[model samples]
Target chain A: MTTITKLPDPVAGGSKHPQRGKTPRPGRGRRLGDLRIALLFILPAMVGFVAFFLIPTIRGIYLSFTEYSVLGDPTWIGTKNYTAIFADELFWNAMAVTLQYVGLNIGFQTVIALGLALLMHRVAKSTLIRGALLLPFLVANVIVALLWFWMLDYQIGIVNEIINWFGLPRIAFFGSEQWAIPTIAGVNVWRHMGYTALLIFAGLQSIPSHVYEVASLDGASQTRTFWSITMPLLRPVLVLVLVVTVIGSFQVFDTVAVTTGGGPINASRVIQMYIYQKAFGESDFGYASALSVILFVILALVAFIQMKFLKGNESDLD
Target chain B: MKKTLGAVAAAAAIALSLSACGGSAPASSEAKGEINYWLWDANQLPAYQQCADDFTKANPDIKVKITQRGWDDYWTTLTNGFVAGTAPDVFTNHLSKYPEYAAKKQLLSLDDAVAKDGIKLDSYTKGLPELWVGQDGKRYGLPKDWDTVGLFYNKAMTDSAGLTAGQMANLDWNPKDGGSYELAIAHLTVDKNGKRGDEAGFDKNNVAVYGLGLAGGGSGQGQTEWSFLTATTGWTATDKNPWGTKFNYDDPRFQESIAWWAGLIDKGYMPKLETTVGASLADNFGAGKAAINTTGDWLIGQYQSYKGVETAFAPTPKGPEGKRASMFNGLADSIWAGTKNPAASVKWVEYLGSTACQDVVASKAVVFPAITTSADKAAEAFKAKGTDVSAFTTHVKDSTTFLFPIADKAAKVDGIMKPAMDAVLAGKKPASSLTEANSQVNALFK
Candidate 1:
């Protein structure tokens, strides 16, 4: 498994066309012999990725084109699945819900995570605080969802118990359609806030203390130091977080499945839940695949746009 | 290097083939070998093992090996095995799933097998055999047992309500406004805060125990909601498609059921949704917190282990609809079509369908025996526990149960129905909206 070369060969579409000297003539720089050896070195990983991730992804897209149930063979119905998805008000509703979820996750979660990261950097490096902060991330996602579900249960929930002690009317955490999404989003944020902070923390840690020291000596105020140095530097890490969190939000299934089950009437029904219910629950694999393709397209477009803007920010860093 | 690759690939191929061939039947001419059987219950393992023992003692050629798993895991593992074609020789099957599997030609149709062993559908209950038949009219399983819901009550709670066990044994409603039930519930109501449910001066909020216990946790066995309400409305759980096509949650009758159901929760007659959902349902009733809990026939053995609590059974209290209804479901033993020893598996089922084993199964009270004659054994066992279980048997016989159709889509519909039912019962949405959702679900079936 050793990477003998400093730079590995590009095996993007994979060993499907394994002509050793198959690189386009215009893009050739790393020689044929080097390419041959590099392909040999990367063959295991190249095969593994293609077999596991790439092929399935391609199949998923192809499936998005067709109608497939997980049990039986899928039939090619061309754009019918896609057409159904576009026409589905419920599916579109889920999409709007997902976009809202993504926006809140990226918009609110980013600022909060960055703020926490900044606070953590100011404090002395202590494992107690570091470990204590990362504890939420350590708990399994399903357990966290269940715990929050119990905490927020309307009638017998601890949340209502506390609220009732103060002689206030109980707010149903997931009871009402309005509160359910926010409550789910809140749980999602709590679970991932630690990971986001940790991501930005790593970015923060990489920026040498001398940069801050130099800024301080330049008479940079705490505000200036943060905006000028920290914020700019954290942009790369923040972009990574934003992209992942957005995608992760689209992939939110376990929480909704366990907590509300896409309910109070499909208010929290994200595309993933819909896709799953169609695919596994209903055995409408082709329809599910079509929904999945829509999900992929949405995710890809968002990622494209976000990263396009992010790449602009990143270039300013270099 | 080439030799090494070849050897590794060869070893892997050999290992796979070995596991693959492990599922095939041993040659009859050859010596005896062990066979694996999978069953779902943690408790019924012993009963099955005893059957295995009896089988092996008579026929020394096959040594039966049994691996126990819970229902959910068993289904997951069963699905995986079905895809892989390494499923067990004998396994438990349900009416919900058998039809779909049988339709796919996955299950070994026991028709020929039944004939070979001199077993007949008439040997068991009439309704039981119908459960194992798929959409194609193929008999995939032998009737294992059937389940019907019965109203179970606490003697202590009824005693406090000034009701006698004798009066309740043959209790009936006058079919007008459920005034008889309201009176019974009033007598059963005791106010911890000294406010009685029956008294004019009593406060509904201050009442302690409710007359009828409906549901505990969230998604119960569908007994509290579907049986009490949906049956009264004259609905069977099927859409145009086999999978759930209609979500009748928005039906006025259904909503009325929910509102009536909510009254139980509203009046402290039942535990809140979370408390009544799982193990705590049994525990809550066992502690005498509530008087009567609506449950299925399965809980009879389940409640037997409860400490300091002797349980009794009753029929579901008739509603204003004048229909005394019960939701009936049956479980059957299906043979795998791809089984190496289909003949032997059929032999095993013939044993299962026999009066001897059915009697044992009934005597254990694991489930309401699907066979009528053996079901008497279950009734006798329940009578020994001081609770008459004949209601389960008689209810199925007397009442016309709108049974689950073996549509290819039934299992899938159930998945959608459970959560939708949960939403309405939880009061997250008003009962009126259930019809809209139910219609939308019906559209899916269409």
Candidate 2:
């Protein structure tokens, strides 16, 4: 039988594996054939990292400090772009809208997703329902956004027709400044609902149903049983879904663009849209990169706090 | 079951791909390496294709490969190509965007090309060559076409309001007391309660239609719309104003113009601000939703689909300055400085400037020739479609116009202008507060 030999990366630090094979001394040539084979396996990935990811990433960070127009040589005006970005009211406004969007949809996507997941677990015996429920999630997000745009058009939209049928005033889903962000959030929720539900459904299925039956036998009601049994068990999956959804919400762009064009005045403008505008519409890449760096820091910080507060480790699963 | 689900997910991911990539089916094996040409107007490409065919007949070695995209996408792709180093050999240029590209040194200077081709400056409109000149006084493009802001009013709407075409044709604005055009606009304005704006004691809140439509807020900066307000109010966009970097949109006259524009929205004479930011003011007019749309002469054929709609052209309403003032704007054929063959590129530009090509381009549609002589063909093209474009020539003498500035800092100004106008349109900021935008833009320019 063949065994794989691998060395821990210096960046990753100390290996956890039981050392049956002798480790090579630092900077010394490899003595073992397995070590050479391991290197051969890892070489492609390391080359790819250097060629594609690391080089461009470093360059992008360097470019962030300059006011580049993409067409010409980027002139370094160190921190000027960053200073301008902070002073920009639209940048702040876009950040606020993005926060609102993330805050609004984070709870919504999770709640709706978990609710559907619970419902799916209850009805797990039905094959057709399980398959059909996920169609919206299966559909492409860009297509979903486009479909919703047409469905929400002012003059001839289906959403209006449906509301009119109910004797309620037709809502201007995409156009109105007040409703634009909410509309985008709602569509985002609708698009992701099925996939998130599927994730929680898998998580739910992993939990033995005997515990639920035990609770029922102990005279536990559905609500009481869910809070006591399901809530504790789904913590790990919930944390994962929440983290991903929050990140996704912060980066939201295409839908807002397809529907509103940041219109009725910057009401639906988001950070990514601002980045896109500066980078393309105005050809101000340096400022856009500054925005990007800000966004990256926000995402990283948020993710860190989420990891700390939510306790995503295995010990918290109990 | 999990394995099957994984397969389905994988299939879905595969389906998620399929970006509309790949060039057209490879052309017939020909000697002249295919030159990539980007264009926006799908309606106008057949003539380009015809021109390409004619050009190919003369130079069999050159195959003009054309890629048509929307204006928004065209700019997006061209800008992306600048970074990727895969930009097309040739593409259309606009006054608003040329400065940035030229400043970046992305555009090739046509100075040598123009001289070599013996292309005389006298053939173009006075000061027209300045449109393609970068901030450093480098000429990067040759003038392609000229367009001046004017008014396109629905004759049917005016006739129904009991106004004659002759009166509307010469309609001018005096921004001082809301000129004669505003008076007529008031007369034509209709409310939800069917009250006319000109009627004594007419209600403004329940307005069903606005008589005059000048694109406002973010879109007011649109060439025709903003030019109408600024030129009439005596704000100079060119010649005297070297600070293309900062707009005086915050000045008293400009603010008053903005207030007047916003008043149309506030009074319910026009659509709500949210309703028309990036939305088509053109489509609004064509649907009989609005009566008077302030657009350029080029929009003459754009509204032809509106059945039986008799549209007439008029100069912008005169402002406090009087004299029905306006600004002239135009487009140019720019060469990218980073191009592999600057010589080959100018030959292409010179060909575009040639009367034969301009005639071909003009004969096809309502596009006015940048060349003075071939403009009649464009006018004739419009006349064939049963619309006279003679009004375009008449206003050139009186209008104080310039192309949209291409200051190296154009991107910075736009960044400031978009949000500032957004604030004004949303009513969060006063129109006069645009001085903040002006200062921010000025900072970038310096």
The TM-score measured for candidate 2 stands at: 0.87
Off by over 4 Å in 2: A1-35, A73-84, A161-171, A315-318, B1-32, B200-206, B214-220, B237-246, B397-403
lDDT of 1 by residue, B34-89 (tens): 66678787766776788888877877887778889877568757754665556787
**Which predicted model would earn the best DockQ?**
2
- Predicted candidate 2 versus true structure: per-residue lDDT over B202-254, tens digit per residue: 77755667786645554435566556666666665422343354456557777
C-alpha lDDT of all candidate models, in order: 0.67, 0.70
Compose the digit string of candidate 2's lDDT tens values, residues A1-318.
Answer: 122224333312343432623553431333354568768989999987766666655666777898766544568999998898889888999999999999788889889889889888885658788777788888888899999887876545787788868977556677677888988999999988888999889888888778888999999998998899888788877878788889989999998877776765688889999888877787677788788888989999998888788876543234
The DockQ score of candidate 2 comes to 0.22
How many steric clashes does model 1 contain? 24
TM-score of chain A of each: 0.86, 0.86
lDDT for position B312 in model 2: 80
